[model samples]
Target chain A: MSKYYSKEVMDRFMSPKYFGEMKDADAVGLVGNPRCGDEMEVYIKVREGKVESASFRTLGCAAAIATSDVVCEMITGKSLEEAVSITEKEMVDKLKDLPHVKVHCASLALEGVKEAVKKYEGK
Target chain B: MKKIYLDHAATTPVKESVIEEMQPFFSERFGNPSSVHRFGQEAVMAIDKARKKVAHFLGAKEREVGFTSSATEANNLSVLGAAGGGHVVTSSIEHSAVLNPCKMSSGSVTQVPVSSEGVLRVEDVLKEIRSDTTLVSVMYVNNEIGTVQPIAEIGKAIGEINKKRKKKILFHTDAVQAANYLSCDVSELSVDLLTLSGHKIYGPKGVGALYIREGVTVSPVMYGASHERGLHPGTENVPAIVGMGKAVEEIDFRKGEEVKRLRDKVIDEITSSISGVTLNGSREKRIPNNVNLAFEGVEGESLLISLDSEGIAVSTGSACASHSLSPSHVLLAIGLSDRMAHGSLRISLGNETTEEEVDHLISKLPPIIKRLREISGR
Candidate 1:
């Protein structure tokens, strides 16, 4: 049985959305290990104090990759301050419902936002 | 479509001869071996004959072999049955069956560390030994990393400590994976206690044996009617025990040589064809039927999925804990920096594996690793 990630999640992880980097960006941050179960990296482009462009790459379980994809969609046009507070529960909620084993992938999304906002503020 | 079975270490199909031998026990001649009736006598003689075969296989006295539900139970009886004392000595790479009981036991356990090669240094084990040390349990061969330990040498050292200190310390080994291909003679290995599971040797599950030298006293972990001389209780699975004995009888020490030849072919191909690869454990000391490796810049779960699609089966070291995605404790103890550990996979071969399957795996695997690494941009 497929325990952790669903077909939707697998598709997103296999062919991730907004997965590349940007030379012109307000913030860039990456968390997790490639050799580890999951890795999430975020790049944000801010325009007039709003997130104009957001991209991510997730080297993780199917849920982790899908959450990163959805998180990018969720954060676009939102203020950097608001984006940083995104929670894993909200991420899983966006995906309808993730498998019991992969709920932690949602938390990785939260960490990515938190770190990216930190990077954004430093600049 | 050709489907290759490379997971022999997990379990093997029951052989035809073993099945034939066990047929009568299930139907026409069914009887409790402990009963005094004619049917019971048939069961009793059969059980005794099988016991003798298993004992002869392990080069131990027939009376020393006590059959149990499984190797996991046998391991518990060995580790949890420790003489209350200083600490237990063991390797970090031991199977959870051994590690879990040791971890939960009241006796403090010092998990002797393993190098990147996954070999436990005798000196390191010796360093862990102390005046209050009650037992030293290490596997004859590692299940994940495939490393073969020097059980005899380790046992002898433990024996020397017993003589010097005039203590009753015991030496135990979980020889399940090792028993299929390795020489597991307890006398030659100088082990006071040993365990082997039936499933690992192509017999049915829930049946195994523990060899306790005539004088060694192990406190029974399970509370039941005094059975197996009070070591294990409840009705025995005569059919499975018979199968276990048959499996033991069928193991050809020469299979070790054949397995090594196949192992070299598969391992050489996979590591050579793939990039950013590392074979985990002691290369020289590993079992001939096992291979564990990590692909850098790849998630093991993802790789496993890709292989699953190709009809190839394997296991990643990390398993999801109850409601939590956690890496394997075995990998964590070996200190693989969390990430390196997740990308590891265990591919164990069986008696029926073929060179064609090895070639197919080698051809199919490199592309997947390359594609996954590239996609992840690592």
Candidate 2:
């Protein structure tokens, strides 16, 4: 176990939730860095201006995958406004804390959610 | 659930025999070798026997083997000692131990690049050789991708130059990764200095040897005691040296052929069956234990973590650079795009690895890649 990582990170990495894509999704969010070798795609199903279901797919480190799971759990069943407003801080705070090096994962997760919501709104 | 370790190129577990050999040195034979008493003389004898074992393994004169804390120290000493105020030449794919020392040398440094497959061209190295170049250091086998450099061919080229030059240029090789799997006879490799680490070959850590050809002069890196014949000055690590000696003495080059079979099976199964998979390095010229692959659409680090969770231990790159999120230099040098480089995995087999362990890895890896790619939706 790396001293750099927290127990929460390891737990989340070990059994990430809400992983994989959703069928008949209303919107899809994709974000990645070719250089960093991290790519994340988030799928959403919206009902009555609220997030009905959420799921994500990602190719990255443990932190990136964990962040994706965390973001999906945070936004599902929430109003689109609330889901889009979810900050990187709010997601990380929910994870207890992310490592300093893995903070980018939170941002990427946020981008994934925001992109999904934006595509759903047709804006 | 049994954990499978496939990271031997990083560091290997100490063998039971090596531990047994090292036992007496730490307890009953605990003596500062500098003392003139019987106890000290006994300690001295142990180190001498260890040195002779290492020397015989490398086909070197017994006196030419000098012990150091690790291969990194040996590399530093060789580059700094021999390249005294003169230019040094090295490769881009060398371990940081060799690369950094050459970088800090008093003389100018030139790094010859390797081919996209991570093979260093002899002609490319020859072109970088300057009249004032005092040393040329290259690794015998690359750590990340396991590309075996043409050391003998490079040595012949350097030898030709040495014969014609007034200041004969010296050649050094960081053979830390090569000692277990390759022919390391210094005369055959034709290197003036070679660095080897004990931990890489199932011996105790913090013990390594630098095989310096007789009559080759390298300035001392440290000052204090006259130990290691003034080249590396420090008190001897008696127990670790004994362990290292035992490790070298027991090494069987033939066993590596079995390792190669298992290594190839993993490579063939993974690359052929898995999507977005590509083998890294020149497969034909690689060391027997090495299998480095890049998975397209999946990040290497994530795959590494997933495999770890599945009771399989491996690496995305060199253990030294694992903490850094940046792509490996060796991968980039081999013409892998930032994406491909970032998605690389290195699985090195050891003597203890079995066909069952490899079959488990192959069965586990495809699903991991599939899941990560599915998550990515790309």
Candidate 3:
């Protein structure tokens, strides 16, 4: 195991949850920088004002993938407004702790979710 | 749990015989080689023997080899010590050991680009050579993709140029990755200097050797009591030096051929059986032990972790750069998109690597790629 990666990060990376695409998703959001080598897409299935389900597709390092999965799990079952408010810190906190270099992954995840919400609202 | 290590390019486990040979130096023969007493003389004898053994292995004179802490140190000395204030030329895909030192040269440095397959063009390097270009450093085998450059040809070109001018141009090859599988004959390569590492060749870490051809002068990078002919000044690391010598002597070229067979099988199987998989470097020009592959829609680090969970060790890129999330500069230089470069994995084979281990990794990797892809929703 790498000294830089936390156990939770490893666990999340090893068996990521909320992975895959939602075919009937109300909206899909993709966010990544080509130089960073990390691209994340968030798909949301919204029913009423609450998120019925959430899933993600990500191409990146361990932290980026884990944070993408974590963001999907965190925002599920929350109201649209509440889901949009999901902080990047929440993703890192859920992962126990992210290395300083991997902090950008959390922001990418947050951006992905917000982009998905925006797509759902027809923005 | 069965453990399968495929990260040989990163570092290798020390061989048992090497450990046995090095045992005495750490304990019973613990004395500084510079000391005048009998105990110190024993240490000195061991160092001399090691130097001679390494020199013999490289077809070099015993006095040509200088011991250093690591391959990085050897590279620093070769680049900075030899041409501290002169223009340097190097390929885009050299290991940091060579690239960093060249970048730090007091004079301007020219980075020649490689082909899409990661092989450096000798013509490109020759074209970049200017009158003031003091040194040309290139890696015999690339650390990231295992592409083998034409070192001997480049060395010949430099030699021809040196003969034409009053001021001779030096050629240095970072052969750290090649020491295990390729020839290091300084004469055959026609290089003025060569760098090698111990850990990469089943010897202990923190010990390496640099071959400076007879009459070639490289300024001292550090100041201390005269040691390593004053090129590198410090107490000799007797144990590591002895282990490195033994490791070099123990290499069996036939075993390297076997490793090539397994490496090709793995590469053929993965590239043929898996979807969206591409080989990174030139198939015929690559080192015998390297298999660098890219899986579409899969994050490299996630794939590495997934493989680790299955007791299979691999790397997304160079082990030295694994801590960074950025894509490898080598991969980028070879014209891979950021996505393809990020999704690449380097699986290096060693002499001891068995067919079963290769088969195990072959059987295991496709599913991991599948899982990551499925999760990725790509």
**Candidate 2 structure quality by residue, lDDT tens digits, B29-128:** 9998988999999989999999999999989999999999989999999888888969888998889888888777888999899998899999999999
List per-prediction Cα lDDT, in the order shown: 0.79, 0.89, 0.89
Give the TM-score between model 2's chain B and the true chain B: 0.98
Candidate with the larger TM-score of 1 and 2: 2
Q: lDDT at B372 for candidate 1?
A: 70
lDDT of 2 by residue, A88-114 (tens): 888788888887878999999889989
Q: Write the per-residue lDDT of candidate 1 for residues A23-123, one digit (tens) a residue.
A: 77778778875443788888888887778989876666556667788788788889887787777777777777788767767777777877888898887
Native-vs-model 3 lDDT?
0.89
TM-score of chain A of 3: 0.95
Colliding pairs, model 1: B117-B281, B117-B282
Report per-candidate DockQ: 0.32, 0.57, 0.65
For model 1, the DockQ equals: 0.32
What fraction of the true interface does each of the listed models get right, in terms of native contacts kept?
0.27, 0.77, 0.77
Positional deviation of B321 in candidate 1, in angstroms? 7.7
The list of candidate 3 runs beyond 4 A from truth reads A1-7
lDDT of 1 by residue, B38-133 (tens): 988898888788889889988999999999999988999889875454478888878788888987788889888877677778888888887778
Give the winner by lDDT: 1 or 3: 3
Docking class of 1: acceptable
* TM-score per candidate: 0.89, 0.92, 0.96
Clashing pairs in 2: A57-B375, A57-B376, A58-B375, A58-B376
